[model samples]
Structure formats: structure tokens, C-alpha cells
Target: MYKHALAAAAAAAFIHLPSTAAEVVTQWNFNSLPADGATGTGTTAAAIGSGTASLVGGATASFASGDASGGSSDPASGDDSGWNLTTFAAQGTGSGTRGAQFAVSTAGFENLVISFDLRHSNTSARHELLQISLDGISFSDFALFDADAGGDRWYTGRTVDLSAVAGASDNASFAFRVVSAFAPTTGQYAATGVGSSYGTSGTWRMDMVTLSGTAIAPVPEPGAMALLLAGLGVIGTVVRRRA
Candidate 1:
């Protein structure tokens, strides 16, 4: 009787095991602002979870008053406002000029995903690189975005999976480091105008950057499952003997 009772309890516990649900670890649409009617260039965006996102590199990052005339469609929210990272010739050239970082705490997620909307007035072939860091200092390249080469203003959506980079950590950080310059002197790229130097020269823009992941559920280890089965077998033998 005791053996059968123990086996039943074991099975019941296994059946009642809770399943883990995935969640949005962090998302930054760059829509929040200070009520004081003041916004800073490097201000951090309010995110969904405990993590925070902030502009790292660039002369200054701010919200666009309106969408670029020839650029990507304005965010569906129609705020006409989105995070803007502007590159100026006055600053160093290339990817070092613009960068943003999104850091999150409490990891152990599967299918880590990231998405962003971007627009640019600069000539095509300008490069945007995405990097991920486990330590928040050393970063490895995760993805890259190249301008359209057409030199027209446009916005486009991009998605990336970072499950490999995210690993099984409980805490991880992702950074978008954009290095840009005047579009190279290529066939159509040359007409875009002088690279970011004189007047409102150098500029790259982005918006609606989001990070998300699904929670990873723990599974019974092989040894544990085997032991449980063995216990059930013993329970069956004991019940048959009693019968």
C-alpha cells in the first residue's frame, strides 16, 4: 500500500509541474520623455523590465520632431518622434560615431530576439554593426546592416536571433554600434552629397529598437527520470506480490 501510494504521489507531482512562459525581457521604443519639457541627448529610455537603454556614442541622440521627408515610414504609433543618433563630421568618422546599448538582468531565456527600425539620409553602403557582450565590456559582432546604396531616405525593419550569444546566462547586454561615413565614391553613392562635414553633413537615424526572449523551462534530468521509473517499477512489483 505504501509503495503504491508513493508511486501515485510521484506521478502526481510530475504531472503538476509548472510550465514556464516566455516574456519580453526588454523593449525600447524611445517614446518616453520628461514632463518638464526637457530632453537630454544621452537620456535613457524607459524599458519594460528592470533593464535600461541609453545612447552611448554619437554627438547626440534625440527624438526627431518629424520623420525624414524621404526616410522610412514613421512608427505606427505616429508619434512623428523616434530615437535619433546623428553623426557629425566634427565627431570621429565611421561606426565609432553612433552607438546604443540595451542591458537586461535575469536571463535564462531561449530564442533571444531583437528588432529595430532604421532610416538614413546618408549615402548607401554606410555600415551599422550589432554587437553582444556577456560582460558588458568586451563585445563580439552579432549582425550588420548596410545602407541601400540608392541614397534615398527610407526606413526599414530588421530582426536578429541572439540565442547563441545569449547562452544560458541570467544577465546579458546587447549593443548596437554604428560606424558610418560619407557613402563611398561608388556609382550612385557619389551623388548623396559631401559626407558628414559641412552644414548638416553626417547623419544616421534609427527607431523602435526592441529586445525580447522566451523563458526557458527546466526539464527533468535523465538520471532523475530513470530513478523515478525504477521507483515505479518497484512499486508495481510490491503491489503484485501483495495481490
Candidate 2:
């Protein structure tokens, strides 16, 4: 079976759950303030995807701040750089291009499944890459699968997966890194709109992002629970007096 075959099927079914807690985990999508280096800001109120990077791909990455239903747009500038998105242009047009997005430690989500959805037609290259990371600082490439080519054109879509990053429990963070790594003159890379500064941009466009993961279960770092109980009692007295 195609590596993404399951993802596409799973993608359809995964959106409705609470997404707050689960073994699979995912970005419920937040559409407000931008996640630093993304395309838009917090006011947007749109969810980009799970993981630190924008589920979408680009040069200046795109990220939303809300969930699946309500979200805003995330733009890609230069300043923000943790888990970001960038683009690969061709000739003068960005049509024949590739969208590159990633997961960052700062955005949230720790060790879990992470995947990217892509639409490829006549890919010049065989292996397209979608990977993950533990610290927004370091990176690790995970999967290699062929981009599905429908014709000599590109389409739009999303990507999701379970990641293989390390130290997830301790850091409580991870990142998704995307690169138009294999720069072939023609093929999926080209068809999807990612060519050199001079090649005929192929055709890659991506929209929609999400991040879903069961945050590292609250272990309550040593005795924190005891302190929590004490704090609650104090608040309880205040409520009684107000009543």
C-alpha cells in the first residue's frame, strides 16, 4: 500500500474528535496570533495543523491559529524562524513550485506522528521527503514516499503522521522540517512549483494545517500535586466568602 494511503483515509476521519487528548494526537488548529515566523497572526483564528511547523508548505511559511472549523491566514516573512514554511520558485512564477513547512519546538506538540500531504503528477524525482524533529533546534528526516502524480500537474492537500523524534517527554516539544531536498530539474519537485530561481515553476499549492497529539501526560513534576491541592483550598475559601 502507498505510505500516504492510510493517512488520506485517516485524515477524513480524524477531524471531529476533541483532539485535546489522544494517542494519535493532532493540531486542533488555532487561528489567532501567528506562531512567530508564519504567514499571518493570532487575529486570524485559524488552525494550521499539528506540530510546530505550518502543515502547509512555502518559503515564508503559512500558519493559522484556530481549529478545523474557524481559522485565519498565516503569512511567511523573514524574521520568525523556529518551525517555519518556505517556497521553491521556478522561472519567475511560483506556480511550478514546492511548499516546505515544518514543526517547531515552540509551537507545542511533542513526540508523535507527523505527516505531509502532497499532490504530484510528473515528478522529476522519485523520493519526496516529509520529516520531523524533537527540538526546534535539531532535526530528523523520517519518511520517504513517492508523490502521487495525477497528470503533468500538481494539486493541493495536507500531510499528517506519527513522528519518531527523541527526548519528547523531557522537552515536551518537537518540530516538522520540510525541504525541497532533492532538487531535480523536472518531476514532482518541478511539477509542484519548486524549481530553481530560473526553472519553470511546476505547481504546488497547499492550504489547511492541523496539529494533534496527546500532550505529554501531566506527570506533575515531583510533589507538584501536593502543592496544587493546597492552592485549590485557598481559592475555595475565597469563593465561599464572595457567595
Q: Best candidate, TM-score-wise?
A: 1
Segments of candidate 2 deviating more than 4 angstroms: 1-20, 23-99, 106-111, 121-126, 151-164, 169-173, 183-200, 220-243
Candidate 2, 1-243: lDDT as tens digits: 443444445444432333445343443232334345433443213243334434333455444222212212223333211122334543323332244544434334444444333333233332355555555555555655544444333222344446344465334455554444453444333333244222222322233344445654445555766665665555555556655
Kindly report which residue stretches of model 1 are placed more than 4 angstroms away from their true locations once superposed: 1-13, 16-22, 33-43, 65-80, 89-97, 123-125, 149-152, 166-169, 173-201, 219-243
Which candidate has the top score in lDDT?
A: 1
lDDT of 2 at 162: 60
User: What's the distance in Å from true for residue 224, model 2?
Assistant: 8.5
lDDT of 1: 0.54
- The lDDT of each candidate is 0.54, 0.40
Error of 1 at 80 (Å): 4.8
What's the C-alpha lDDT at position 233 in model 2?
57
TM-score of 2: 0.43
| Model 1 weakest lDDT span, ten residues long | 184-193
Tens-place lDDT per residue, model 1, 87-137, is 343322443334566666545666677777666554323555677766666
